[model samples]
Target: MATRARGRGSGRHDGQPGHGRHTTATARPARTRNPLVTAPGTLATPADRALRGKAARTRVPRSAHASWLPSVDRPDPVAVLERQGRDRLPELLPIRYGRMAASPFAFLRGAAAVMAADLAAAPHTGLTVQLCGDAHLLNFGLYASPERALLFDLNDFDETYPGPFEWDVKRLAVSVAVAARENGHPEAKAGRAAQEAVTAYRTAIRRLARLGELDVWYTRIDAEQLLPLARSTRHRRRAESSLGRARRRTSLQAYGKLTEVVDGRRRIIEDPPLIEPAGTSDMAFLRKIFSDYRSTLSEERRLLLDRYRFVDAARKVVGVGSVGLRCFIVLLAGRDADDPLFLQIKEARQSVLEEHLPSGPYVHHGHRVVAGQRLLQAASDIFLGWMTGPQGRAFYWRQLRDMKGSADVAGMSPADLVSYARLCGTALARAHARSGDRIAIAGYLGNADTFDRAVTAFALSYADQTVTDHATLGAAVAAGLISAAPGV
Candidate 1:
């Protein structure tokens, strides 16, 4: 059983809700006490760790995970979302709501806070890992590693933090269920799809447990390996096409599409509300922070960064859950006019999981995000770094695009979804094995499919809850209680 606590008070800063202003606040130190630490002693051996995991089953039965009745006093999902927007840019909150209202799957992507609260309401196996925090179906994708090898892994970490390993699994399972329903799959098929993800997670963890430390660390799901998993020739061709598209989605490709030469100098093209020119003061602040960000990188990386000259920047809205956060894209030229690089600086707020679990090790939210990404990813962006800006806002920097691609979940056939779900589960288990105790987790899971079946039941139930929650958000928008700019 994991120790639990209600989240502490939120960090608050007041700002006008409109566009074009940098909301500033004094930086405050994060809580230093870490409640997750074990007793100070020699590390437990694999046998001992496995025994400890088995011991946990007596306290929190595997069957306990299947229960998913909404508590009588469950927080209203809409109110929970409104609370998150309190510190966000006011003008953009509607866009977030609009995007979330588009589908139950979209709502699941945006409602990490809601799920965190619900997960906290239950007892856990106490197996801890650096969670992806919001491990919905869409968050898993392909990206180029530092070595330029394409690998599929968890790509989003805005809410990454330390917590019970099952939280991530449950989130992933629920997402699979919700996505299947949205694609017009029946309840039985959705259940099977969700079950496949948990089964893969269980089996993968067990396999990783047998590996040596270095072998576990070196494990990664390369894009080339995915081709063999495709069931038919058509599916194989589709996989190849997707991989080809991802390979083309590099900084050079973005430069061609997102830049236009203005007065003989390259400038980021603006697409109103979605993408717009930064104000003069915002641009100056970005330039100053560029050095602060550079300091966080290694000497070699700094030299690589120094080769590029800053050309232009623009504020850009991105993603469903992240719509209201402060984000900017900076354009830099490496050689002459043809060579280009794009880096994104996005705001990093506290993880939604923070309130449910104990405080994490990082003081700055940006450092927390960067560190979590490095720990959870098999290979991370070479340019990954973090910095503080005016008003002590936390922000992390990374390449704007590096062969990134996500599956089209809504268009997937039932078979395609089940296969994709298993892939995501395998990738997720590999991530957990890197950060958490694989031996103990594999022990707790055991040989039976009990945990898998239980989580599948929970996923189906939660998918129903998500539908209601999604409808509730739509109702709020319909009643004029919340504004939504649909189809943006």
Candidate 2:
């Protein structure tokens, strides 16, 4: 029989891992950097290297972390969101707001900065890992590895950085709660699903911590491994369907869908406000950008890329949070008219987590994103690279769509959601264990429900806060404080 893990089972792990306690005035004040802005490289060495995990686990007791409430100093969530929107494409700003206003879940997806501010204000465990920074339920997806094998892992890293590992957990937990609520499930169901996710993460981390370095590095979750975890035939069918869909989303498919024959040459189709061709001067500049981007690739990849002739470039709006950012898809054609390749060049800003955590060693934001993505994903795109673009904007390059597919969380049944949650949680654990001190994190989690319950409680509370925040955003749009165009 499988041994069930045990712990307090009652107290809340509610706020940040160590938030809400007051210090005595008589005692000397604890000296630390501005908690809101963690300096880079501070966690390079463990506080007590000899028994780091044990020391950390002792510092933040499992049972001691109960329900978490927001601190009085929590920054205004709207102000944070607005700060991110600044300098983004003014025309697309309305569309970004519209997408976020669709649901609380959508709002949560766009509010990483809001959560980052709140998290920075919360109590922390002082333990660090390569955080996904935006580990929401939808961010975990299936993609093709270099060997053409399908694998599941954290797919978004625009916000990746080293920070308190629990920050990722907290973000993921709240997303589960918000998604479950969007699906009309009871709060209890959401809580249960969030708990299952945290439990899976804790359990997987512990298991990985016991493995050798190479074994942990080799760990992966693929379609074959995930199929058996499906709770029902319906769930299995959905999983297979999603996998099939991803496999068919190759460059050839994209070429057919996004390009047109113009005077015997292939050119990107125009779809204003979403996808539009670059102007004459803009095209000339993009050619230079592509040249610079090629230098960042490996010698072999650069040679391979040279075989293809650049055909066209277009601006495209992609994803909820990334809608207003400067994103583009460059089209290229090989010697054979039928051969095609697509590359995505996305703007790389300082990570939302960067403001709250210690900065990384890399100075270029694009390098930072690519490095972090390579660190977390089991395998990354062969075309993965980064470069500084026009006006010194940092940007990363990758295949536009290499068999990528996301979960339809809003449409899942309660039981299916729980299963999917576990898959995501397990995937997250694998990614973190790749670069984190899994032993110490596992020690903190133990073989119990203490951390699980605490995270679930916090997730539930934050989901409520997100809903209220979404309403505030909606009201702002209604009152013309911010322009919005829904369903764009």
- Number of clashing pairs per prediction, in order: 1, 12
* lDDT, candidates in the order shown: 0.87, 0.80
- List model 1 lDDT by residue over 1-488, tens digit each: 11111122121112211110121211211134222234565567778778867876875667567767766667999999999999888999999999999989999999999998888766666677889999988999999999999999999999999877899999999999999998999878888899999999999999999999999999999999999989999999999999999999999999999999889878899898999999999999999999999999999999999999999999999999898999999999998778899999999998998876655789999999999999999999999999999999999999999999999999999999999999999999999999888888888999998889888988888888899999999999999999999988
> What lDDT is reached at residue 381 by model 2?
92
Q: What is the RMSD, in Å, between candidate 2 and the native fold over all Cα?
A: 5.6
TM-score of each: 0.92, 0.89
Which 10-residue window of candidate 1 scores lowest in summed lDDT? 17-26
Candidate 1 Cα RMSD after full superposition onto the native fold (Å): 7.9
**Local lDDT at 66 for model 1:** 78
**After superposition, candidate 2 runs with Cα above 4 Å error:** 1-51, 63-66
